[model samples]
Target: MAGDKELAGFILFLSQFPFLQAAKILTISFIGGSHYLLMDEISRILHDNGHQVRMFRQFGDGMLPGRQAQQSPYPVSTYSLGEKYLAEYKALFTEAQKDNLMGRDSLQNFLIFLNELSHQCNVTLHQSDILNFLKEEKYDLAVIDGFNPCCFLAAEKLGVPYIAMFPGTFMNAAKVGVTGPLSYVPIFQSLLTDRMDFLGRLKNTFMYLGSHIVDKKMDALFQKVIDEHFPLGSRPSIADLHLRAELWIYNIDFSIEFPRPLLPNIQCIGALLAKPAKPVTQELEDFIAESGDSGFIVVTLGSMISSLPLVEFLKEMIDGFAKIPQKVIWRYKRSEWPQGVNVAHNVRLMDWVPQNDLLGHPKARLLVTHGGLNSLMEAVYHGVPVVGIPLFGDQYENMVRVKAKNMGTFIPPDEMKAEKFASTIREVVENGCYKTSAMKQSVILRSRPFPPDQQLLGWVEHIIQSGGGGHLRPYSYQQPWYQQFLLDVILFLSACVAAIIYLILRVIRALIYFISNRKQKQN
Candidate 1:
């Protein structure tokens, strides 16, 4: 019943349907947290659909392997975890942390890390060593990441169909002449429903295998893919990734993000996380009661953007809430408060918090965020307004959605001053538009016929019933990116330009020499 509703909602809004079937798919990812989430979902969908699935995931806990890949071809397969890649992963992080040429500014550090991550991603995916693990299996379609385009090569070498699956928030999926972006919204999808404050959540970490801990460990496993295929060209460039696919499947849906550019081959799958049988926990109810009117706000910068690095920013935010009678619960990583900033009387801090639960809570009046897609969706799900402070990656673009819907205000990372922070919070609180838009978003979410998970699973089954995702194949994969970009002729033009410049320089030199020789003869 729930599934039907999800599909109904999606069908109502799906401006267009994508050609999303595949047979004998080589699904791959480095196994980082979000990436793993996307890849796993893809594998599950493909597998459930009755298609032959070959998964090359780097971050298999003890259940997945590193070197030798296990193959099932169809009915079943076991992807075991391995620790062979840990030392190298730690080394990379150590090197990355050590290479932190950027001082304490977390924002710059994030940018630099993003650059390094791009470079590193290219290095790991292209390793010849992984080819040894490729079973005697054939893939009809392929899925690759924009960050690591090496899968294009993998698909070409394997002679199969290819598609790009982006778990991260990106906008290239909506570029010119395509029609897929209409349904894509970047967000994380999880089934666990629990409510715990920052500290209580941290306190709960050891009790159960928390997603946070699992993700960190998973990132290590995924890092190996980079270790195997890196340092493309003498100089590092993500351009080296150059892996192409027949279609690109984005782990985002369009209901949350409207006005997206239309594109072909790029499909929206953001609502992939919405699953049936999701249960709520008690810890959630207590937190909402604690807020006691004036409604508290949930402030999180996400895991990638640290609260410690944004100490001054956090201080300003806390100060802003202090002026108002509302409560402010910040997901602060640090144990102690720094000087020059007083923790607001109604504020609480912890290393991590149960975000989904907190967002659902009635007290979650407004959300102050770095505009990570996952958080944005959670806020949208509960109809809570947002105050976006986008930092990097998709955050900037995602915030545009926040502003477009009149959902809330967006404060750039640099413009986030104490005074502005206070005023923005007040405005979001006092203003009717923000809440009205939030409620509209909530209606949009609830309006969907099926939850996200059902839509995702139904599509998976749709592919399987059809037999090996042959229907999903593109007309052809003959055009390379160079051909697509016209770089071949551009290279020829560059050479021509160089030759002309050389010839012109030679003529100028000859003229000068002739003039000198003539003057000497005259003398």
Candidate 2:
């Protein structure tokens, strides 16, 4: 309580700047339930601060994560990517569950989805309704999804300075711009730690470089869209537009991530966007209360991948849960649920459950998750141990940190057996180390000097007040890529060494000719 009060006082002190005034803000988020949730939170904060806030996102029947689209507070404009790509989206995750996410087949499926998403975004940005509204409204600032290059292009067209918001610790082609030192920083899905021996560092470097190569197709697709729209003037490439954002707010913080240097423009607001767990219903409360001394466990794969029906995996989970005395709640789509797996009396299945709230419940013993950043953050905030079954994109890497910190353990879905999966759950539940480490880490997470909301509003206003990040923007951004990488310095050094070598060769040839003439005269 004292720390929170002190932090509030500090924020009040910083709020005295003259430039702090209300402005019109435009926010955009396309696809993904978690993505929209982060954007919704930022929009709400800005709106509460006396700013005119409007949001743009995709909406279909039953799309938004926890609520209907009508319930949103902001003035929202929803677009549809149409049903054509919907099947493709489902198929992408289908292939992901069948093959390892790191495999060639799965990557190709993901790339196809990226291309489809890019094309859809291009249509949305150019549509008569969305573009005309954006042009006329002339928002003071645009808060855009960092993954969507089209949003950056839209904000640029409207002549609005914008900030980038990421749902997780940065991934995708945009990472190419902000990649830190390769010696220590691990790429998403690499599963490498910051601490590395020579062999590990070598592997890390390859994975980092290889990720860029694989993402070039997606980058090219985005570039094609950007070029068509912004071709009239001095056009910056898509990479340049990413670095030009006034600020970047990431959904990850230092406690869970490996140590790495970051630019001044980047901020870690982590769980600040996460809403406190709402109260569970009395019926659900009764169910949990009935579990007695042994608490229940919660299972969710997050909003995106939760619907996948992995036949054997589901059976293994069901069989494993049957052996445990603790009650279990599994959030899964009933339409997709396999008939083969027999649900035990101790287990209940719901199409949607309040995951964050359930994790916060005192009777909640553990979390079985896909390791999405949002799920992980909730678990950490509530101090619940995890059993990770990572599916795709950063899940593996996220779980690696979970294992390293002793907060949880993970089983790759392919290697998962009924007995092994059950035992892993039992281990996390019975072992005191997992719970103890989780509580200690929770202290570190909650102990940051500034309250997350204050930190968020402070930096957001700072960027706007200073006229777009001011000196916070790195000088390296202004330099050409060659200069940034020190290639120019290397070229100069190479030329100097070559000139010295040439001179030395000439001197040796001249001496040899002189010696031969002397020998001829002596003869």
Candidate 3:
């Protein structure tokens, strides 16, 4: 039979790596384009190594076509969240684009939005045939996007050991417990550098507490949904699932992100999604060739920012692009292009752009980005300087690092103006320091012990062969937070010291009283 031949071929191929065994790997991702890219790479790596890989991704429009899995080597299944949920997501994004001061209220709204998403995911998964698929597939490992709880729930129902993939900078501060005193490491959504002054450190501590609070509240909300869906008996809490993950693969590097104390189970496989840059189309090549010495700037605000609500913001970008002599390629996703605007001959607007290829082009001078991790990593891989216009979420933190590393300057979205934007663009394009710094970072990023894909493949196989690598988990994950941080020890020692001081004071008082009584009797 054809199935028998396929099985035999896989067995023979896997024989080349005697110590390694092929695994049935399942990657679960939803909603985000960048997440799909990461998961697709994971699936590709596993499949290329003679493993059976299956992917379950959410189906929807508005995702960039380029990020989609075109000709995947393994089987992929899709789930639908429907237009109602899609509209809700759009509303959330529109609300975020308003650029209100990120305070407690904003964080609360964000958490509530995430809960709504979790409910939608729960409903979709329940409606889909995912459980039956899992039963038939008999998967050996489940790779899940850690940000969402739905996949975690699926993996649990299937009763499979899994690892979590965090596609961006550290999201769970409490889980990872990164370097420095709590005051030093900035919290999620913190637009701060690692080197904090007194006030900054104070703010950082509050942000840490605030994040923990928000996570606890969010966990409870998600847990209620999990209970409803899995109402058989007690299920593991979401935090428990995170702690039990055999390994965590982060998409950031220490060269860009601040150094943190990572656990043995954690690893950074940055920029693994990018392949060797392919040549652009002849038309694009001609456009770049005609630009001559003045190279073009590639501008994109990432896939999530589909439309600009403010007409002035779009006009400002247009005005800035028209003034620049170098050719411009702006990748904007909007159903209707704004009217009453004069687009310059040097500027080109399209729904999507070949971002990685263009960044690698010889005639590419600079990149203007919204500081998404995927965009930043690609820009760094190609040794291109960036002009970061941070909008929200980790974008602000990502740009802060860009500026800290001297690779670029950050222009806050609220403070953007045509003249200032153009001036800053000119400054980065004209300055050699930015380019030198970016190239230096590029060298550091590429100087890993091994290629990122191979490294990831090795770790993933190790997890599979070693029975989820249970030995790699830190002892601290099992310990209470107070004990892990030695807070309990500190408290016990302080209590003993206070008791000894009290006893010493009582003995001294007794001695003084005896001396006074004897003196009085003699007199």
Alpha-carbon RMSD of each model: 14.2, 4.9, 5.9
Models 1 onward score TM values of 0.60, 0.89, 0.91
Mind giving the per-residue lDDT tens digits that candidate 3 earns over 373-483? 889988888889999877656777889889999999878776777888889899999999999999898888878788888988888888988778689887877788899
Error of 3 at 464 (Å): 0.6
**Pairs that clash in candidate 3:** none
Task: Write candidate 1's Cα lDDT for 1-523 as tens digits.
Answer: 9999999999977746544544566676654544554566667776777666766655443222121234443433223223545555544444443333122234344444454444444544445455545545655555655444444444444455455666655443322123221113321121111333455444444323343343234234334444444344432222222223444556655546653453444556664543322333565355456668778788886553333444555566666677776777677655445777777787777556566667776567888887777678778777889998765556666776677777897887666677888888889878988999988987887677776666555544454444434455443333565875589999999999999999999999999999999999999
Estimate, for each residue in 417-460, the C-alpha lDDT of model 2 and write its tens digit. 77898899989999999999998878888888987778878887
Better of 1 and 2 by TM-score: 2
Q: Give the range of the ten consecutive residues with the poorest summed lDDT in model 3.
A: 97-106
Clashing pairs in 2: none
Model 2 lDDT, residue 420, Cα: 90
- Runs of candidate 3 with Cα error greater than 4 angstroms are 1-18, 65-69, 91-95, 98-105
Candidate order by lDDT, decreasing, is: 3, 2, 1
Question: Any runs in candidate 1 off by more than 4 Å, and if so which?
Answer: 1-27, 31-33, 40-115, 122-131, 134-143, 150-160, 168-170, 174-244, 260-264, 274-284, 334-342, 458-523
Displacement of the residue 45 alpha carbon in candidate 2, Å: 1.7
Question: How much lDDT does each candidate structure score?
Answer: 0.57, 0.78, 0.79
Alpha-carbon error at 283 in model 2, in Å?
A: 1.3
Q: TM-score for candidate 2, please give it.
A: 0.89
